[model samples]
Structure formats: structure tokens, C-alpha cells
Target: MNYKDPSLPTAARVDDLVARMTLREKAGLLFHTIWFAPPPGAETAESMIDGRHMNHFNVLGGGSPREMAEWHNALQERAAATRLGIPVTFSTDPRHSFSSNPGASMMAGAFSQWPEPPGLAAIGSAELVRKFADIARREYVAVGIRVALHPQIDLVTEPRWSRANGTFGQDAELTSRLVRAYILGFQGERLGPGGVACMTKHFPGGGPQKDGEDPHFAHGREQVYPGGRFEHHLKPFEAAFDAGTSQIMPYYGMPVGTEHEEVGFGFNKGVITGLLRERYSFDGIVCTDWGLITDAFIMGQEMPARAWGVEHLTPAERMLKAIEAGVDQFGGEACPDLLVELVEDGRISTARLDESVRRVLREKFTLGLFDAPFVDPDAAEEVVGRADFARAGFEAQTASLTLLKNGPLPLADGARVYVEGVDADVAAGYGKVVATPEEADVAVVRLAAPYEHRPGAFEAFFHSGSLAFPAAEIDRITRLQATVPTVVDVYLERPAVFPEIAEGAVAVVADYGASDRALLDVLFGRAEPQGRLPYELPRSMAAVEASPSDVPGGTADPLYPFGHGLTS
Candidate 1:
């Protein structure tokens, strides 16, 4: 009960809470389970928050800001009434973007819509990065989200990696700079009341996957370091440590041909304990990536447990290995019963249990959750996605447009224009709209670069596999260009092999994520394209295949090297 006292230090409060907890309550602290948004009028939040005795959650989908704030307060109320009265902390993947992968990040629903992390990297202003983080922190705190599972500092060394959208680009120094700003933005000078703690992720870096495959599936489980650049990947994390991030999350990919054990980082004692805990001296919480201990169905599709090299181990064995590897919590999984069983059976020592529970409780205390767990729902309605905040996000989206070619840019006003992949109504405002490329003075086309499509709705969201455009799509671009001057824009989530698009399009522009108006603003000279290439755009898929995964700019001759951009 003394833990509730505001005057006590966080350490003293953590000690009080840990000493009072039973083995079951301590076990529950080690799990941060997933919770999808239920339909309106559904009665599920209470069961998961109180009935299951879960205190940490990774929120998947959510409704309006006011609704989410109310729901969170309701959950906290239920938790407050429970014995020991631990407050629930909610975490979420990056949400202020166009991408809507429920597993990776959510869509920009009622929140200020900023371009993803790469867009921030493109803008290349530490001040802007910090401001974005602060705004995100304010919106998150208003709605009861206390932890951010983002600012993925992984270098975009392997251009084909599906998760590059969440990175600060391929340069270690640039990523490190942004990482410092991001941490400061979320956690502030110190983490306490009003601070939204940042969980800097994929420790030692998650990039450099073999053939750029993600570790979410069996095919993408291996992370190779052929260029002998293992230490190079840790630079941003070192910066993260300096910035005082609240937590670290290791990747799921198993290392191949490295000095570390050839298991997933979540279970690699040498990587987690030796590199992170000992060498880096990161004493904060270490949570495993989602779904390492058990299989779960997502979006009506069955997914195998992402245990990687340790698939042969049982669930209990997996938990033991993760603990021994120095993990404090498990993401996307809740197995307090299994943890209870392990301690009761004498397989895991209670001393080991105390170690993790202390770290978890310390965070709760530091967050001031024990003193003030609830938020004002009325204030949340006013704070979330205010007009000023949304304008800044829109401005950043416009600023991030990367101009590859400016062949007669700022096309003369009142010229006849034909457009595709852009709103025709918006295009009409700039010039007279034409039906075909032949009937226009200039043509505009927008396309997302191609990838070898994967099955399943969940799998499809991750645009992995090959980075090349198909022949037909490439030919179509060339034919349209022959008829008239064509301005083409490609949404570059991954580095696309587009030598043909580069040569054929009279004007080419690249964007991470932008609105129809934002893209047009850049084309018409209304907004400056302030982004540089985050990663190398390889000359061909052959060059990408030949390059080493771990090495940045490994291709012999990239069409566009890192930091390449043009001004109109």
C-alpha cells in the first residue's frame, strides 16, 4: 500500500510492490499480450484487462480518440479495483502512416497523419523529428497509451527489407542522430508523468536479412552478416542508450555465420545477455518480438510460432531460454500459468522471477501510473489530432517528396493534363484533364513498385520478395512516355529496381507516403522536395542480388546512391 505514496522513489515503490506480490502476480508482469479492438457494444475489454490479470497490452485496432480514451480509463478503473492495484500500460506499433498492416503498424485513424519514419529521415531535421515525437507523445498520453513500440532504428542496409518504412535510412550516423531525437521526444528529459516511454527496437539492428526477407515467417528467419558488419549495426542502439530509452526489443531473425549463437536474438544469450546486457549495459526491460512462444491466428490465417532456430523447444523451454537470454517480457503472448508452472515445478528459480518483476514494476512506478493511472477523456477529445498537429504532418509529407528528375517541372498552368493514380478532381484544379496520354500536353502517373506477392491477408500486407517491376508495367510506362511528357511518382516503401522508369519518365518523383495534394504541390513547385534517398536504388535486380545484405551501398553501381535527390 505504501507503493501508492507519491513521495516515495520509484525504486522504493518497485521494491514494495515486488515484495507484496505472490508468484502468480509476478508471473503476470512478464507478459505483454495483444488486444484487438472489439466492435462497438462488445463486452471484451473487462475480461482481458481484469479477468486475465494482464497489466500490459499491445493495442491492435482502435476507434475514435474519445472512444479509445474512455475504453482505456474503463480498463484502468477495473485494474485499480483489483488486489495490489497495478495500472495497465498500453503499447502500439507506429500508427501515423498510410500503411494498415495490423501486425506491423496501424492506419492513421483520427490521429495526425505523418509520413512514416523514412519520411522523417528524408526531412533530415532533428528538430522536426523531436517535434513529431512530442506531438505523438501528447496524442498517445491523452488516450492512455504509455509505451511506443517504435522508432525502429534499424539501418536500411538491405534495401529489399519489408520493414524499411520504419527506419531512419541506411546511414548509421543519420539513424543515430534521429534515434537520439526520437527518444528525447517520447521519454522527454526524464520518464515520469506525461512521458510516453519509447521501446527502441530490433536491438543490434534487424536489417541485413538474407535476400531482404522479414523474420515473421520461416522463409525469412535467417539474418546474415556476410560483409562482417555486425558491430556496425549496433551504432544507433548505442545512441539510443545515450538518449536513455526505456526498453529494447530484439529481432526474431536468427544470426547466420556470426560469432553469436545461430538462434533468434530473443533467445540468443550471447547477443541479448553478452552484447546488450553486459557490453552495452542496457538494464532496461527486454521484450521479445511478437509471437515467439506460441502460434496464433491473425486475420483468419494460421501462423506458426516465430521461434526461428528454437522451434524444437517446448513453450516452457522457449520461455526459459528467453529468460536465460535476459528477456524481461514476452510480446503478443500471455502465459502466466506456464510461468507459474515453471516456478512451482522448480524448473525456474524464484530469484529469476524477482529480477524481471522488479524491472516491470519499476517502469510502472516511474511512469507515475500508481499515482495517476487515469486520463481525462474530455481533454483527450480536444488534444488528439488537433488542426495544428495535422497541418505539421501534412507539411512533412509534402517535404518528403524526393525528386529524381524535374523535366520541365512546375508545368505551365492551364496546360491540358492527363493523370492516373492521382485524383482526377484534384488534377483538374491544376489544368484541363484529358482522357488519354495522346490528348494531353503532359501525362501524370503514380505507381507502387512491384513485389512478388505473398499469400494470406496478413502476409500480403508485408510487401516482401523481389524488388523488380514486371515487364508489362514497365512497358506501359514507356508507351505512355512516348505519346507525351509523363511525370511519374512511385511509392517507395522498399528500394525498387526501376531503371526503366527512371529513363522513360520525363519527370520522376519518389514519395514514402503522401496525399494526392502533397505530391501535386511538389510537382507544381508549391512545396520543395526536401528528401534524399534513404537507401541505394540499385541499377538492377542483378545488382541487388549480387550485393551483400549487411553492407550499406553494396551494389557495384546503384542507379541512385544514398542521399541522392534533385531540386526543381
Candidate 2:
């Protein structure tokens, strides 16, 4: 077939292949579902690929590098045996970070660990962003993950929003400055064979949620823009589009009171078709956010699909609406049967299905998956989490630590230290690990950015709602500060309210994601804390609540403003 010829142009090959694909095969191309990290040679996925004709998968869990490579090889081998022999394209959320919010990113179990995106935002260096993307690209290719569901270009204007930690923070100009570098590093000047394709996400801005609530759940549906900075938020995404991002994932939030319809971005025709497709001229793959058509069972709890304004519609209607809204594929879903039904019943046209299929197949061809899909397990083992990469990651972790208040930092050696929320052995390298504050000369306490505990295990993965530390917890922390000259390091997953801790602690540090060693390196005189706050740390929840969700840095009295940091 002409489609099998590598010498042929991609468009010609895509056209030829689309003509030959069965309705089932064509329907399968419209759905990109989660693999949920099955065993290396799991027959379940193989059976589905052959039976349902599905090929796209999201790598949802972690394993050894060799094991992941072996799994990729096995999956490819199955594809080779199929009638058309289309290679499976594997995608993953950010896995090179310390924070393991399944909703946003996963843990770097064996992957080289770097700081979170907010940490990258704090550094605010385009070159550094490029370097990190390059390193991440190399690691991803080693394990056969061809697509990255990240470079989450969503602005961090809404400080209390759960997903801000994964995004470039708060400034349109800074994020725009960094996004071109990010895309260039990941996919080079152009996406081709051996390059990891970036899916820059939550299109047309997902920030500015009502009451700082994430739209992943039903209660958090409305995405308001009272500040009318809608055009301001599009700057980063416009940059991403220009840099040749391969795919786009619109967020679940429905734009309320805007020129666009009240439905979610995934279901809103005006936003997806009119804005992203027409205004921005982004012709890349437009996939919906996870579970837009069906419910999910994540971390052993039943979760509803984020249908937003279209919750009243059935799953099939929702699927049809998303397809009509200019979506090329359904993310985190597997029901191509409904699509097949839609087409057979004449609700969806063959031309429409082929249009999306062409886009999906073109990426597969451009990635050279059809020609060479297999990977070497040995190379995977050697390249992943290697010495230089690990060292670079550690350096980034150290570089991104923000010293909010430098009081009594750069502590002397052999000082008696009372440690809380840090490993004793790790802290011992810098000072004597004392059992109690009374026995110690100084105290080191590590705390996570406060988040409201919602019901269900899956819901808890998203640290949304109140940024304020609980009253009792604040009291306990104050009591600890009274014991000794306490050095407090709080992990700022998102912008938080911690004025009391800022005032009470002798020294206060903010880290996006760091190890005990990295913290100790900065706490001691070994490494300089060169990071700054990505967004303002508001003085109180009242300040957080009173401030506009769409606007950045207008709190009543911020405890620490953006770019606030100090050196020891």
C-alpha cells in the first residue's frame, strides 16, 4: 500500500491510510484512554487493541525503566501483528517531579526528580526551562513515552486553585518568554521522529475558577472572569502554539459570563472551534481533559465525569457534543463503541471522523512509530535516572529553594537540632540531631502548604479550597516556634496563607519540591537559596477570598509578594 511507503509525504500517507481504515479502526483513533499501568505483557491491553482497534494509551503508573521499555516493546509487537500494524502512542503526565498529585502529575519513583513547575516558574529562566525539557525528553524517549501531557501553559492567576503547582505561574509575559524555549527543547525546531510531542494543556486559560474551586468536580463548574483579563491569559498559549506544540488539551472549566458559551471548553464550540481553532490557528490535535464522557474510579473511589454545563446530557450525547466542539480525541476514556454507534446512526459523519483520524495518524507517522516502534531495554536501563541527569536535577532542586525570611540561617556545624517532618539521618549531616526542642539549640520544621481535606481518596489528590492553615495546626506550629529559634520550610504547592509562620519562625523558607538533603544544603551554607515566590502568599483567607480569581497579586495585604526572596 502507498500508506506503508516512508518515501511518501505525510499528508498523502495519512490520506491513503484513512481511506483504507475500517469504521472500528477509525472510531478507535478518536479515543485516547488510560492504560492504568498494567503488567509488562498484559494480554488485556493486547486483546483490546486487536478487538477494539485502539492504539493510544496514557502511562498512569510507575515501574522500573527496563520494565517500562519491555512493556512498550510487547505492546508494539502486538500492534505489528494487527491487520494495519499501527504503533501504540504512549503518553504520561509529568513524572519528573517530587509532588505526586495523580490529578496533575505523578511521582518520580525511578525517574530523575526535579522541582515542580512552580519551582521552574520561581526561577523564571527560559534557558533553564529549555534544559529541563531537554532532559525530560531524553528520559521519556528512553522508556517509549512519545507524548507529554504537559507544559501545562495554564496561567497561575488563581492562587488558590489546586493545579497551579503544575503550571507556569501568574505572569503572562514570563510564561510567554519561557514557553517557546520549552517547546523547542521538547520537540526541537519541529516535531519529528524520536521527539516527544508536547500537549500544551487547559486551552484558553483554566485559571479564574469561582471561589478558587477546581472544575474537576461538579460543585466547581463555573470559571468566571470578573477581572476581564481573558485576553491576558491567552498570551502563554499563543506562544505555545507558535512554538509548534503537537497537541492541545482544553480544561474542564466552563467559562461563565464571557462571550463564549457557559459549557466547558471541551464542549463549548465558540471556545474550541472559534477561539483555539480559528483565532489562534492551532491545527494540532485537540483532545479533551480526562473523563469528559464517562465516570472514573481513581484511588478506589467513584468519580463523576467533568461534564460541567452538559451534565444533563447522557454520556453518548456528551461524546457527540465534544466531537462537534472540534475535539479530535476523548482523553481518559475507552468507549469507541458509542462513537461507532453515533456514526452508524448517522449522527456523526464519516468525513468528520476521517478529519480527526487524519490528525491522529499523521502524528503517529511523524513520530516514526509506524517504521520503528520498538525500544532497547538495556538503553532504557542505562539512560534513565543516570548520574549526570540526577545531578542536574539535584542542582535544580537546590537552586529553586526560596528563602522567604533569612533569620539565623547558614547555621554553624555541630549545633544541636530538633527536627520535625524531616529524616534524622539526613539532618544529622548539618547538625547534631536532638530528640527534643529543650535539648536542642535550634529547631528545623518542614511543613506542606495547607489544603482543605475533601471527602474521598481520589479527591484528596487535588489540594484545593482553603489555603489558610487550620487554627489548631497554626497554634501547634506557634508553640513549636516558642520552643527554640525555629527554621521553617514550607512546601508551596500553590500560593498559601501563612503570615503567622512567616512572623513566628526565626527563618522561613519556601520550596516547591525538595529533599531533606536539598533543604539542609540551603539551611546550612552549602548551597545558596536563589528562588523567588511564583505568586503572592496572601496574608489571610479573608485576603484570598476577597481578591478576584481572574486577577494576579491584588490581595488586601500579601504576606509575601511575587519575586520576594532572600539569600543567607
Candidate 3:
């Protein structure tokens, strides 16, 4: 396969392929995986095994589009049977929409189903979030996905945080101008050939947590900044490192009592080498925040205990404290032979594995993947599911519909509407869709609460040290919002109070996923809600058990706060 010389300079062809690799090919270029297992007696053995052994790290998920081009041609035939053939970047996580993580669910069966990220920041279009990240980078590089763990700009000020529907709501100047127009529409005007890279994630901000839970187990591993406003979560990660983002992951909470570093921010070296590589000069690739070096298990159970303030350190001491807290990589299913047993026990340093294998081979040589590392599985059926990308995911689910209250919302067009709790064919296209709510002139409920992954009880359901909700489904939506003029809505990927269906509705919308014709085009006014409350709405679980589990503000209050939202 004729080599080198493609007019050098992707950091000198990744430092001359890291001076011709070896150290298990530079620890298999710092581990990453996404699919490809089928070997031991083939025929998809429980979807290509995971009993752990020949493991790499990252491993992409969220299928279809000919199963992501047959799992990227079986992850490039297992990186051409590793041994320096390299090629296997892959990555992914936000497979284009409706996020609630079934390992990055992407199936509206062929991508392009936007409106989630608080409905693209309630449709305050940065050119429609860069045309939905350029049609999700042309359906993820037509099915080989070169790297985009996602645009999780994180700053929906914590409402019981179950991945606040992949944030972009609670304004920081409109999430710093739509996270720099979604990293210039998924790394285009650069980052080598046909772009993708982009990894912009959890970094210095993973919303305040603590009371908003989620640190992926261990009671949502603390991150309170109180009114210290935690440096306003590092201003949209310094506007996503001045909109160049080639990589950065950082989360796994633990900013306890702030001023940074109480451990976890991938073992904080004052937050990744004192605030993202020496005061934001970035220099790409940071990673780490997927099973932060072990002791985490889901669906197989065993997690619980980390409200920050480190304690259970083992996964080879969190992989030598995340490579002396600089971390170049190590995500999900970790075990790059514990980074080749901490570089054969001298405890890391082969010039720190050649500076994280030269920033993971300069992001696989700025993602040209050495000039195309395979893709055409029949042009993934003409660019994976393109009905104008589901009509631009139903016009970003009708401009992220919000409408908090409109008295008797635009109902009058042939009204006999009573549509409660969705699905009578998504509420018979908005009118005369009765199915009892005491049958009649306007009720329409449509709620959503379905993510019960107990995984043998993830420390009694991911913490604010004990979140709740499910009193017989909030007493069956407070007995169908006491019979009539209802219009509830909810679907808030996390954050629960419901205060008896918000003091018995006449209006209450909230969203993060909508598409029953964008919930009946914001229930009849034909789309005008402009979604807002991207996290705060507490108003009782006794104001979330009288606040302060380590800051989430006091007096709880909230029946909506983080950028409120409502505009007829």
C-alpha cells in the first residue's frame, strides 16, 4: 500500500507515523472501537461478543443504514488485523437526534431526525444549527463515521440531569452562538479532507449536576458551583475552543466545592492541564469520560458511591490517574492493556507514550483516515435515509415547539379534541382525536417517561442522592389533569416534579423531543412555541427535597427557570 508523502504536514504526517510505531503499535494508537466482533463461530454471536479480551476502546453504536455500512466494514476488518495497519477511527454518539442513549440510539432508521438539543436551542437558528450539522455530516461520512462523539455543549442548568436532552438551551449567549455553528457545521472548512472530527463535549461544564444527578452512576458524582456560577461553565468551552474542536471529552464529574480538581474531569490536572491544555491553546485530543477507567457496569450492574471526593480508585488506579491527568484517550470499555501496563510498570513514560501517540496520530492525520479507510457499502443506500433528511427532521420538529400556555391554545379549527397521553396514531393529526379525557373540546396530554435502566439498581437510580417520580405515574397524570382544558406535554428527558400536573394544566408544554407533527404544530397555532425551559421546572418534590445536596441552588422553587419560554 504505497506509503507516506501526501505533501506532508498533518503534524509532519503525525510525526512520521509516530516514528514508525511499536509498543503494540503505540498501544494500538490509544484504543478506540465501535463495532466488529464476529469471529468465534460467526453468525452474529450475541451481536459480536463483549466478554472482553481483544478489546480496544471507543466502540461506536446506534445502527442502521445497512447497519452502519456493515459496522464500517467490520471496523475495517478489525483494523486490518492490527499490528500497525492502523485505520479504525469510527467514533460517534449523537447519531443525529432523539437522544436518550440506547448507546446513542440513531434509529428513525436512516438518520436525520433532529430537534433534540432542546429542539436545536428552540430553533434560534444559527443557520438551522448549520443545516443540522450539515445533514449530520452527510449521514456520518456516508456510514464510516470518522469521529463526532457529539456537540453536547452542556449548559442546561441542571433539572435532575439525565443527559439534559443533549443541551443547547439554558442560554450562554444562545449556547455561544450554537456552539460555533455546530463546530462550523461538523468540521468543514478544515480538519483535513471530507471533515468530521468535532468531539466537543463535557469539558469544564457538564452542567452543575449534584442536584441534577448524572455522572453516570455513583450518585451523580458531585459538581456544585453554587452561586459561584462555576465560571459560567467555561463559557461554552471557550466557545468550543474558538470553534475548532477536534476533540475533548472531560466529564465524569467531581468539581466538588469548585476551584476545580477534586478528581474526575478525567482526573483533573487542574482541569486537563490547567484549564484545557494550558489556558486554552487546546492542541486537541483529550477524551476520557466513558467508564472513567472502570468500576462501572450497566445492565450488568455495579455502580454507586461517587458524589465526587474520590474513593474507589482501581482500574489500575484510574489508569495512572488518567495519564497524569492529561488523558489523550480511554473511553468506554477501557483496557488498552492498561495502557500496556502503564508502559511496563515504569508507570507511564515512553515520553508519555510519545505524547499520547502524537495526539492520537494527529487525529488520524486530521481524519483523512489515511485517505479513505473504507465506506461504500452500496453508498449506504444513497446516503442513508434521505427524504430530504426526513424533511429536515420535520423542520427541526417544527422549530422546537415551546408554547408554555395559551389559555385554550389555537384549538378551534374543527375541534372535538381530547387526545391524552399520545399515540392514537400520534393523536389523530391534532383535532377531533378523542379517547377520553372526559371526551371533548381540548385536552391533549402527550407525556413521556421511559428510561428505567436499573442495571441492578444504579445506586438506587442515579443520584441527587435519591431522585423520584412514579407515584403511580404521578397519580396517572394527576387524574388526567382533573378532566379537561388540559394540554400538558412534558417529555423532559430528566427533571421531574410535575407538582400535580403543574397545578392542573390549562397549559404547560416543555420539550426535547417532539414530532406528532411537532406535537400538533404546537397544538394548533401552527407552530409558535419557541421552546425555552431547558432545565429548572422543579416546584416540588418538596422543591426537590429542599435543595442543597451540595448546591443546586436553595429554596428549589422552579416550575421553570433556565430560560423560561412561552410566546403565543
Query: Where is model 2 more than 4 Å wrong at Cα?
Result: 40-43
- lDDT by residue (1-568, candidate 3, tens digit) is 2235566777777777677766756765565544432222433322222222222334344556766677666756666555455666776677666653544344344676876777777667788888888788878888777688878887756555666677785567788899888888888767766778887888888877776667776656777766677777788889878888888888888877767668768887888998888989798888776666655555566654232455667677777777787887776643567777778888887998898778877777677676667888778778876888778778777667766655777766667777755666656665667667677777777776334444354333432332345678778777767766778877766655666666778887777776677777767877677766555666666666565533333435576666667777
User: Residue 138 in model 1: shift from native, Å?
Assistant: 0.6
Model 2 per-residue lDDT tens digits across residues 418-455? 99999999988888999999998899999998888999
Candidates 2 and 3: which is better by TM-score?
Answer: 2
Model 2 is weakest, by summed lDDT over 10 consecutive residues, at: 38-47
- C-alpha lDDT values of all predictions: 0.88, 0.89, 0.68
Clashing pairs in 3: 33-59, 34-59, 34-60, 218-305, 403-529
TM-score of each: 0.98, 0.98, 0.38
- For candidate 2, the per-residue lDDT at 80 reads 84
Predicted candidate 1 versus true structure: per-residue lDDT over 506-541, tens digit per residue? 888889889988988888777888888888788888
| lDDT (C-alpha) at residue 148 in model 3 | 81
Candidate 1 matches the true fold with a TM-score of: 0.98
